[model samples]
Structure formats: structure tokens, C-alpha cells
Target: MPASRPNLRTIAEHLGLSVTTVSRALKDGPEVKPGTVAKVKAAAEQIGYQPDARGVMLRTGKTMQVCSILYSPEVGDYGDPGFLAQVESLAQGLEADRYSLVVLAQTSNKDPLEPVIRVHTQRMADAVVFSRTTSQDSRAKYCLQHDFPFVSFGRTELLTPHAFVDHDDEQAAYDAVKRLIADGHRKIGMIDPPENLTFFGYRKQGARRAMTEAGLDPESLIWMRSDVSVRAARDATTALFRTQRDATAIVCASQMTMIGALEALMELNMDTIRDGIGVVGFGGMPFRMLSKQKLAYYYQPQRHVGEVLARHLHDLMVGVPAQELQTLLPYRRIDDLAAFREGEDF
Candidate 1:
């Protein structure tokens, strides 16, 4: 095959130095002489050298590749249109450390971990990163048993030692519910994601907790559960309104769902907020831009999640302790322009 990009071999031959020396210099290995490192870097820049990812993988038994499996970002299958942005952020995070990201397509719902297992057993990647964890995630167990370097975007119920980074979904949900309660919404409703997902349960708990604290019967409220899709959310909202006409407030699980619910209300000619109805949901990025009257939401630390996941996985690959791999980053609540205008950090 033709050389698609500059390789370490090409740089080594140009500088008349061993490929090992070139690799070490590029990585800034402690043992490499500083003068040699500078010379190698200067020569690499002059030749426009771009390290061949495959070659590096072969030499160190480390692909410097992080693999993540998610629904195809191009299709926006996860309801959130920001899926592509998240993937790009992850890629950028990995690229900063000279690592490459392999985003695999999860076309089917059969088993999300199948591709992850394939990649690990086939030695196609260095570390695995996955999200949307369940209560008892088999993928986490598999990685633990095989002793592979991996990190999760959410926590699991398993007791085994593993690394994970997650947003404080429960707290964010609690805040959203509290906002609705303060608005004097008595008959509240929730548009929830599937119950099997770990974050879903956390959010559900938050809503229930807020209702109980306010002396409301959680069971009396409407709960419309659906998959991660705007169409599903729209249909669920339609059904909720059809049944619980008294529902004065609704909380959606995602931004797409919030949009769907809004459209559904518009179709039904229901006056949003004016009819004493309010909406709230969560988003990954640019949450402020999505806000409008009666629509309140928050943005997850998604870019930060990618950055931390990449860095944590790198630490794991380099023999860092598994205990240090876990992190729970805080999220920012974006209610409206006021949050941004008031100098609240996003």
C-alpha cells in the first residue's frame, strides 16, 4: 500500500537514526537525550512527519487507539443531535495525546458490548470507552475478567474494580424537578428514557424524591417512558396529554424529547406555560441556545467527559491504578439566558 501519511520510519531514515530513537524522541521518553529529541522533532517538522498509527501499535503492543461504540452519530439515533459533536470532542481529546479514536457503529440493539469484545480479543485497540451503562453491565464484567484497559461514561452496579467518569445526573434531575415544583405545578409528569439504563434510574429517583419532599404522590403523576428518539418522545407526549389533561408540568429526559414535546403541544394548540404548563429537560451542549419561555434545561459536561475519559484511559494503559480511574464531574444548569448573562460558568 502507498504511504498515506509520513511515518516514523520515513523520519528515521531521513535523520539517519534508528526508528526506536525516533519513536522515543517523538514521545519525549525520559531516557532519550534532549539534543537528540530536539533534532528528531525539528527534522520531523521539516519533513511533515505524521506518525503512522498502525506502526506505533505494532511496535509497543499499544495502539494508542481508544474505541467507543455508540449509535451512528450521522443518523442522530440517540435523539440528541449533539451526538456527532460528542464524538468529535472525544476524537479531539484522544488526538491531543497523539492517540486515535475509533468510533464503531452500534446498528443493532442486540448487545452493545459485542463490538467492544471483538475489538479487545482481536487486539485492534488499546483501550475501550463506552457509555449508557446499565445496573449490572456485562461489558464491564467482561473487561474486568479479561483485564483490559477500559473506562465507562457512567457507573455500573458491579462491585469489581473499574474506571468510570459520569455526570451528576441525579442531582441535575433533582434541580429540574425542584424548579417545576416552585412554579406551583401540582400534577407533574415526566418523559423518561428506558428504565434499564443506569442514568434513567438516577433521574427517576430524583424526580420521585422531589415529589415526595413536596408532599405529592409520585404514583399519581404521569410517567411516559420511551426510547431515545424524538418521534418516540413526541408520541409519548401526545399520549400523556390525552390521558392526564391536568398535568401542568412535564420533564423530558433529553433535549430532543423536549423539542418533541413542545411540537406536540403546539400541534394540540395547547398554550405552553400560559396554560400553567412548563417543560424541562437535559442537553449535552449549547443548552442556553435551546432555552425559551417555559422551557428550562441543563447542559452536561460532555466535552469535559470526553477529555477526562481520554486522559483516564491513557492512565490505565500506562499502568495507573484502577481505583484512580473513576470520576463524577459536575454539570451546569442552563435555565435561560439569565444563567449565561449573569456570568454563570457553562
Candidate 2:
């Protein structure tokens, strides 16, 4: 079959180096000589090598491919449109070397570890990156126990530490809720993601902490879980208000959750501003485009996440300690521009 892009054999031929040496140099593997890694990488850029890690593995058992286990980064999927940006950005960053980012889709219904296990058993790639992490995640645990190189988009609890890049969800949630309380919102509500994921717990923890600190009973806050779709959010929000029509503010745990909440309120003939309801959530673009009123939200540098995830994975494959590679990217709070013009670091 015709190659879609340049392969290891092509790089070796162009560099006049053996395929074995080129493979080692690509992965910074054993037997790669000093200065040769530099030469192979340089030629990969000049010649534009799209890596064929599986082909390399066939001969030398080493690869320079990084796989990303992801969901379809469509609107309202997980309230995160950043997932697509991450893959594209990771590809752009890895383009500097022969490393290629391979995307493996993970549906919500499947076991979280299935995709990771596929990579582990097949050895199709050198390392893996995945998101939608849970506390005591099986994927992270398996990767650690098997001595594989991997990076998670969220934290995991294990005896061993591994590379990760994550948003500070707990702190972000706390700050969002605290802002509502400060604004004189008493009957508060929260729309949360599924409780199975670790970030879900972090957001819940932060909101509850903020409520407790204000001398309010955390249990009194209306809490509901939804899929981030307008329909799901509307239903949850409707039920939420049925119990407390006087709820003055809500903390939405996700972009979709926020959007869904807004729709529900509109259906109930309520305007966020008209009804004196304050909305704060995680997401950026859609909030501005969709909402008639300005929204206070938590936004992440998602493209930067891709760049860092790529760098972290490369560092790990080349022997960077997992613990040293852990990072928590802060979420910026974009307050209503009419009231607060700039994003505050949170």
C-alpha cells in the first residue's frame, strides 16, 4: 500500500542511517548514539516525517507514537469542545519530531480501560494520553502497574504517581460558588456532571466547602446531574426549580450544563437578569454566543493543554519522572464583561 506520509524507512534512507538506528533515535531508545538523535529529528522536520510507529515496532519493538483515548469532541457531548482542539494541537506540537498522535475513540458506555488496554496489549503506540478520569481510575492504575508511559487529563489516586495535566476544578468551583454567595444569592443550585468522574467530585467538594464557609447548609443547595445537553439540563433545572422557585443563583459544572440551564430558565419564562438569577459555570465561547446576557464562567487554555500534553508525553517516553510531569492548569474566571472587563486568574 502507498504510504499516507513519510515513514521510518524513508527517514532512515534520507539520513543514510539504518532503520534500527533511526527507530532508536526517533524514540530516544537504546543504541541511539550521541548527536544522532538530533540529526534524525532534524531530518524528520526538514523532510516532514509522519511516523509509522507500528511499522517501527514490527522490526525494533520501539515506537514514537502517542495515542489519545478520546470521545467525539462534538457539542453537548461532555460539555467540552476542547477535546478536538487538544488532538489537533497535540498533532501540531508533535510535528516538531517524528512523533505522531493517534486518536482512539472511547464511548461513554464502554469500560474506561478498554482503549488503554488495547494500547497495552497490542503495543501499537509508545505512550498514551486520556481524559475523563476517575478517582482510582482503572486506566491509570493499569498503566502504572504495567510500567507504561501515559498522561491523564485529570488526577487519579494511586500508590504510584503518573504524569497528568488537569484543571483545578475544585478551586474553580469554590470560587464560582463563593462569588454567587458574595452577590447575595442565598437559595443556590448546582448542575453537576456525572458523579463517577473525579472532577465531578472536585467541583462538588468546592461548592460544598464554599457553602459551608458561608454558614449555609450545603445540603440545602439544589444538586442535579445531567449530560450537558440542553434537554437533560432543562429537565434537571426544571426539577430543581420545582423545589425552589426562589433560587437566586446556580453553579453549573460544565459548559453544556450552563447552556442547558439557560434553556430551561427561558422555557420557564425566566431571564437570568430579569429573574435576578446569577449563573456561573465552566466554558467560554458558547456562553457568549448563546446567552443574551453576559455570563461569568471558568475558561481554560485548552490549546495550551494540547501543547503541554504532547510535551509531557514526549518527556515521559524519554525518561522524565512521572511525578515531575504532573501539572494543574488553572482555570481563568471570565466575569461579565460589563461588570468586570478582564479574566481573573482562579
**Using TM-score as the measure, which candidate wins?**
1
**TM-score of model 2 (CA atoms):** 0.83
Candidate 2, 244-311: lDDT as tens digits: 87888878877777777777788888777777889887853434543466478888757788988888
What tens-digit string does per-residue lDDT give for candidate 1 at 1-346?
8755778888889889999999899889988999999999999889888766676777777777788877653246545666667677788887767788887777645588798789898887878888778989988988988888889888998988789988787888788887788888888778877788898888878888888888888777677887767788789888888888787888888778877788788877786656767888777756543434567777775676777877887788778998888898766666564565566677
Report lDDT per candidate: 0.79, 0.79
- Give lDDT: candidate 1, residue 243: 85
User: Per-residue lDDT for 25 in model 1?
Assistant: 96
For every model shown, what is its TM-score relative to the native structure? 0.89, 0.83
List the pairs of residues colliding in candidate 1.
Answer: none
Top candidate (lDDT): 2
What is the model-wide C-alpha lDDT for candidate 2?
0.79
